[model samples]
Target: MPHTLRLTVTALVGLVVLAVVGAQAVSVEPAATPSTVVRTSETTRLPAPDAPNVVVFLTDDMRKDDLGYLPHVRNLLMKRGMTFTEAQSPHPLCCPARAALLSGQYAQNNGVHHNSGAYGGWESFDPSSTIATWAEDAGYATAIHGKHLNHFDADAPADPGWTNFDILLEPATDFENFTFFDGDSFNDDYVTTRLDERTVADIDTWAGRRPFMIFANHVAPHIWFPESAKGDGDGDRGGRLPPAEAAYAHALKGITPRAFKDPAFNEADMRDKESIVSGRPKLAPRPLKRLNLARIRSLLSVDEAVAHTVAALERAGELEETYIVLTSDNGYALGEHRFTGKDRLSDEILDVPLVIRGPGIPAGTRSARTVSLIDLTATLAQLMSLTPTMTIDGEHFVPTLRDPEAVGLRDTMLIQTGAKDPSARFPGWAYRGVLTQRYSYARRINNGPTAGFLYDRRQDPHELANLLSDERYRAVRRELERRYRVLADCSGTACNRDFGPLPRPRPAR
Candidate 1:
């Protein structure tokens, strides 16, 4: 089916489903009159006094530096918005990440841990616990356009969420709504442009009705290398521009990050390849056999779409009133550590960009404090003065937007993977790690549990050293092990697993 027509029909189906579901689905009671509730003089600041609109602009499988703003995204956001330098996804996949972001809980709690088709499976979404519900109840016009992981069940249709906008644009790829197949660039039209149009129109049309929240998820820059004949350039689909844009390629060629300039560079450039081929491309060469140009080129459309969305928000007089959060579902690995993409536990694939701009946010502020995407839900709930439905694993980071240097409530960021279902890549590679200011340590869990992929992030940010066996770092290993155990005990992930707590007691000053 043609991408345009398919998305249009899909959008209509979404609307009809939402109308039927929104009326029948249970609704949560709102707080009593505003005057009855006490106002805080100090820290309990709402997200800008004027009920500003909310726009969450999410990308597919984007790396932290894929944006034109590059590493200075924090400062860039600060100038126009706020930035969370340490933002992370609960699990480095699509559906799970989206679910956790929307529900404000970890994969174990939400039950959408892996990609929808994995053995453990997807489709079991908690209807009542979604940000859309809160926003709708708060009298905001909610619209979810791009990807709707919360919209379907077992590849079949389901009410996306109780939002005002019934339009859901599901792609033809497996109906999972999260997976972006490589070499299938032609299929990525709705997310790149169509949704942008829809968002702009929605913002313009509903400018005065009430505050609004639009979730525009774009599927760009995701994996799947096109055939080598296409040449490494952004391929041009039959739209405004063709894929494999040379200008974008040249720009990315200059992106050569300082961190990736080592003598021991891998032959396969970790940077995304832009396919410059005309017409539709084939997908047979596979990873090593195909050219990297297509991947880089693919990202151009996504970047343009982002800029367009930002422009739209600004033109509609909604930018300032809208908390525009630009981020990714998960980070992508161009070619780091011999890995092509995510579904692995690595810093390159796990660390994603988080840019926030809107009312009350300090322009150009950047915080290195560890943060996670799950924090976004809590932050949104707190910002809008809504009660989070359940125990949220993430902390409210709205305070960090204002005071970048402000100390956060949580000391560590926990990543759980490789344990639950054996079907996923790197299965049985259960691991946990912490990114401290000075270093990072990760432990591997196997039949006989032990430390895995331990690294001295300060010296080896590339994650080459497996410092698990070195006697000199025994103390470091023990400390990391203890910390991981403590986090696991408190996290309530999957199960206790009886890994036991740290044997060492806290050091006395």
Candidate 2:
């Protein structure tokens, strides 16, 4: 690992609580920063509600490995909840990932592919039988705040079930001006601040009255640093630079894009990645610094947003009874593999941050079990006993949560990108792959440069090396191709495949 990236992982490990019962152990870096520990004070116990209220903080375009930027979330969610280290957004993109979260099905199964245009976007999703409606039917008050799918209109009728729907219509290009369909306009209220306030207000109204589920969707640390941004990142309108509040404009100033220079960053060779990312020019320093720094600065308020949500739940005396989930729709890339955006099936983009606390979950624990956004929604449905109105392609995590040491039911995770659309960031060819605990293999259509590729993820964490063309990998490639075919077009029960223990580990190259 690069020294700086090592520092980040070390710093995060210092903050993570050591655990019991098969918890993953960490060898702390001697120079790791001392943990900035925080503990939320407990409130006086109140009468238990009929069921646990669920609050999900669904952040946008946040990298799975970037949890260190969220101190409050690290201290509160990680320290108090169970962290899923291998959580993934199998189809890593805004519209597809969000659809998976709502429908408990893969992008192919859900019928939502690209971010916008004919085959994708809001028109493709069937929200009529989503978790919102399912939960609402089960007598829970449901609400969602911030960005919905791409191409959804601010004037669009509220999707079926939610009691409160506050959706951001356009890209968060103007944090101070984007309007929520629910009559919210930001004259001066920043995006994160306003979302936090509205969430707190909802907790205040529904905490003691009924079981509730609030999706506090935040556009923090995403792209389009508002034209109104007036601080260090003001000049960054590159679409990759996130908009931070003025107070946080200088935060994380020291951790520039150079800090994340893993071997994959602007890699020297493109022969192996020729299939999709073959000919991109090397990324420049100025843009990398802007993208990295602004991304970090933009998340400071989101950390505060987490703090606010916890405080509100505590004040309502519902903290102990509510299930709090902190996660992201998908992840973004910052110059890794000479790429600057998402929509690729790289580990950097497919992995998503996932942590949960409340009720029966043990504090400071970890689950090594790999799961996807598709699986997460199914798990939520199972937790609430909501009978899905449609077919669910993923399995629930209740068993894994109930027993962290046991192996999970699903063994393979499908990672695919939709065909390029005129409205999206990635104009690459459609690709599909299957990720196991150790290996990553993918194939592309449209006769892209390198038709297929594979990586031994356990050995090549940065994925700088591809093994598909290797003579020794012939057997493994055949097996992976079979699995990929099974999952790429799979639906419902057929989608959850257990391929036994991982294919026998290959010797170190």
Candidate 3:
């Protein structure tokens, strides 16, 4: 399977099976609509009087390729919206990516690099100025449900810019039994379904009054283990995969995942790769299928959630006027390069799913433009006609969305492998490099192996061969490194500039 493709027919039988079981499965109704109705505003002030409402579905640890599990999302959104096949997460970790999403700046500027500590977690984020505040101030009622940031609980209230917020507390990674700020806890109800229902309740109230932007975050399909001691990114905590809705647990019992055919699957060699590939053993076959089965199964509910949310907008007469964006905080690495988590600097982590459908957004077209969570945030704020108090490192790509002929705002930008310590997620690993439309490059910055590799995606899509040390490609590396230095500490306009066409990788000698 290629990086940006949907699952093939043979390997995708499980998706159909899961869909069947999911429809028939008995589930909880959208939790009793919140006691209070959603936010209501007298006016929707904007550059355009009839600007569309924005609804963002941010799934946790979902890969760009996993879009196959979504049937309704495919029919309603993908077929009706623009999909950015080349979109990526600037910092492919939980906190950093979300921080960037909220502030429109990279981790270096936002200060939330890892998952915890001074450099990580909810406390590290500055909630005063963000898309939420920009939208709220601009007259859109804003709300966020489900996961806000890791280590967030009822105790820490930063007012993080939402007019209404209901987020799960620290240790928020689980299928059930976790509590939210409102004290309404989940014991038997599936979190994915619950989040949707709760958010639908908000949509029911908020829509039709004034435009609203809701961030519906979910924690399904993330590797779940409550009893076992689980340290982040340290080999899947012994191969434990999250379970699907109980009724549909065995829906995908027997089927292969297209991801396994991905050339990077159980990479055969690592000598030419990032040092983090300290050479772990290949993932066993049975477990790989088992893990993907769980992912596919878990997503059934998310697909249903997408449908329910879209339907809710339609019922409220807000469907056509709303910009429904679906994406993930970061991508999951399913047995790629023999690694099973997102901490590494692999494309499996760097690349994420970004789909949008709304007013003026061209229908059923895939944007070749290079976009990121950071860029999208800025664009959304720009669409709302808000001039930010904070500097936005990302560029607005409205041109690409409205016209496919337009190039992306960013053709090159800095990419980093987050901290190794506080979480030890990727122990003894830290790096930064530049990513262009066709090239992937990074160099380690921590102790031990201090070198990195370069990949010309046009030729080596799997990133199997390292072009860093190859004498013929010296010009490519030179240009990449030069851009990395400028972007490593770049801010605002300077950071979002396209480095222009990549100097072509030399032909085989």
- CA lDDT, every model vs. true structure: 0.54, 0.73, 0.75
Can you tell me which runs of candidate 2 are displaced by over 4 Å? 1-49, 225-240, 257-261, 420-429, 448-450, 501-509
lDDT of 3 at 372: 85
Native RMSD of candidate 2 (Å): 9.2
Q: Which pairs of residues have clashing backbones in candidate 2?
A: none
* Better model by lDDT: candidate 2 vs candidate 3: 3
Give the number of colliding residue pairs in candidate 3.
Answer: 0
Q: Against the true structure, candidate 2 has what lDDT?
A: 0.73
- Report the Cα lDDT for candidate 3: 0.75
Q: How good is model 1 by TM-score?
A: 0.69
Greater-lDDT candidate between 1 and 3? 3
- lDDT score of model 1? 0.54
Ranking by TM-score: 3, 2, 1
Off by over 4 Å in 3: 1-48, 225-240, 420-429, 447-450, 506-508
lDDT of 3 by residue, 407-490 (tens): 855678788856636545444236788888778888876544347888888888988888888977889999988898888889
TM-score of each: 0.69, 0.85, 0.88
Better of 2 and 3 by TM-score: 3
